[model samples]
Target: MLGVSFLPLKELFLKNFILVRDAHIEFSPGFNVLTGETGAGKSMLISALLFLGGADVDWEVFSGQRDEAVVEALFVRKGEVLRVKRTINPEKRRTRAEINGSYATKSALRERIMPLFEIHGQHENELLLDPSTHLSFFDRATGLSELQREVESLFERKVELESELRKRRKDMERLRQIRMLKEYQLEELRRAELREGEVVELEEAIERLSHVEALKEGINRVLDLLYRDDHSAYNKAYVACRILEDLGRFDRTLRPIIESLRGYGAAIEDSWRELVAYEERLEYDPEELENMRARLSFLRELEKKYG
Candidate 1:
């Protein structure tokens, strides 16, 4: 199994400034303290330690001095050394950091250093006086990490299940639409009495009926050409017969021409009789057209209802 390690501060230095020439200290795993006279630089040492762990510092306090500060730490986990260093230049009021003698970011150094140290100053006494903060510390001390991990795991599972449920809901909606369409189609088919091949039959019937007026006009024109008042087929054939008979003595072929005219006259007479019979059958009943319109309207209504 693998284990994580934490870095720890080991030594700090403040040279030629702030009522101290040089100071060095080694820290242990347990609690440590600094006690000295007033203006002994004890709080300064603590501030320097805080600054090394990415805490903000007031450069104005060390103004007009050669403000050189260095902090070094030996990080031990299971008795192994991981070193960190930080240096500050008072002239520029800027800080620099290194990890294991390699240059590093202040944020990265803070991440490595914060887990190993907890600082409590006079302000912490006020926090201890607050019941909420005290209760929070109690809760945190009492194995809250396990509860937090469980909550996080459950939250992740809930998110995944919610996504799956949304997909299922979408699928169910599609099925419902399909079912509705089928139901409407079934209802329309039942109400309209539409047979399997009824659409083709009705279309053909409608096409024939829609052209009723044009058909009637064409039939009337044929009837007039065959048996009208003056320019009729019968009158034309009769005139042709008379002409052919007058020329029969001049040419023998005129007899056959007269016979052909007689045959055409008979054919025109039969066609006129048929046209009168068909005209009687070509009557348009509006009720049948209204029934077809109603059937088509019913189909369109069903499409709108379920489409």
Candidate 2:
């Protein structure tokens, strides 16, 4: 039979574990022995202790209809109460652990918690003979286990700090490279000597050059119909004003119509003069248009590159 002993076990609770449905066991202080025939669940208690100590188990055999098993143990260590719980869930394919109501990893349970129990199976002597376990026994005997635990904690902290320092250094190096690349790109854009709104201005200039003939033609048509044609609007208004002036001699109310026609004739002549001046200013330089197109293309390329 396997034997287990250690610090005082205050309580052990098991549920859906092997043949045991639900068991709540309390132990007293001092020596205790578990005696039972084969298949009487004596070894099951030993298995529960091992599993609670972070030892892996085949959950299929322990699980109930719900495919879950749980083991919780309360122990008094150095006059302090310690509680540990282990749960098996085959459906999730994972084992969960808790210590004093807080979640803990199985490794943490083995390193910090499992030392509370001393298991003595039939082959326990084999493990006792292993050289790796001797240091732990020596530390306990010399009362230096606490000191060793402090040293281990410091070492773990040092390793974590080193890892964080290395990551920061890597990130800084990447940022340095990125800054250098952006500086080079900025210099390239500066060399181009680009101006704000220059692309829009160039596009407008190009459009004016492209349709110079159409614009000139439309303006000339307006000017001719308004002033240059024999029967132009200006000439018609002048003739109408002269006829109304003669009619005013016959009726005093016709004088108002005559005055309005004269104002209309003068407005038409003013519009024709402004249009002629605008038509004279139209530019048709292909070289200037091509240069504007090229400048616009360059600016667009820069936008595409920088963006």
Candidate 3:
């Protein structure tokens, strides 16, 4: 009892526990012990306390046809009453706990409730033999428990910061990869010498080159019809003008008709000259066409790859 005037755990209550349907125990000041027959529910009382201390137990502890088992403890310190309750539902296969009648977790029970009292079994001396618990005992003796708790908190914070740093490093690596890829793409586009509307211009050029021979043949036919052949429009217009001019000399009413025929002949001559120049300008270079085709193919590949 650590020199306390009253027991820290004042009372323990159990319900629907194995071999003990309902039992209540009250403790007096100083050390206490329970001694009874082999099946007189003494160990069951200890089990109830262990359950209140957040120890895990199986459904068999619920006894008979009970739906749930409950273990509760009351403590008195500095004239304050603190109550802890633990409940296990066999059907649910889970434990529910409370502190001072409010909801609590098993971790809360272990950290806050279990520290209020100590339970010693037949092998209790093993705790003294183990070296791991020596620091806890020393801290308690020297009143350094608060300092240890602070150090533990700081250590936990350090661990959290380290984990966050690792995550940030991974994110930075991912962003670096993305930035490198974008830079590579920019370099490729720079090398490509892309221009606005370039694809449309290339496609039009390819179409023209594909039909260059057909276009030249068509222009030749047009020239023959307009002026190249002996029965062409220019020759006919010239002959018609002469006939009209001779008629106009005989009759003044034919003068307007002769002038109109001369104008027609002039228009035909201009059209024939323009057609001949256009046909001569049409050059079909296979090597130039192949180069354009290669450039266009490369552009299409770039488009597909990037997309």
Error of 1 at 106 (Å): 27
Instruction: Write model 3 residue lDDT over 117-218, tens digit each, in one string.
Output: 454456564345646456677888898987987898898799999999999999999999999999999999899999888889999988988898999999
Better model by lDDT: candidate 1 vs candidate 3: 3
Off by over 4 Å in 3: 1-119, 122-132, 246-268, 304-307
Give the candidates in order of TM-score, highest first: 2, 3, 1
- Model 1, runs deviating above 4 Å: 1-121, 124-147, 182-225, 228-231, 242-250, 255-263, 292-307
Question: What would the TM-scores of all predictions be?
Answer: 0.43, 0.70, 0.58
In the predicted model 3, the residue pairs found to clash are none
- Which candidate leads in TM-score? 2
RMSD (Å) of each candidate, 1 decimal: 13.2, 4.9, 7.6
Higher-lDDT candidate of 2 and 3: 2
Which consecutive 10 residues in model 1 have the weakest lDDT in total? Answer: 1-10
Residue range with the least summed lDDT across 10 consecutive positions in model 3: 1-10
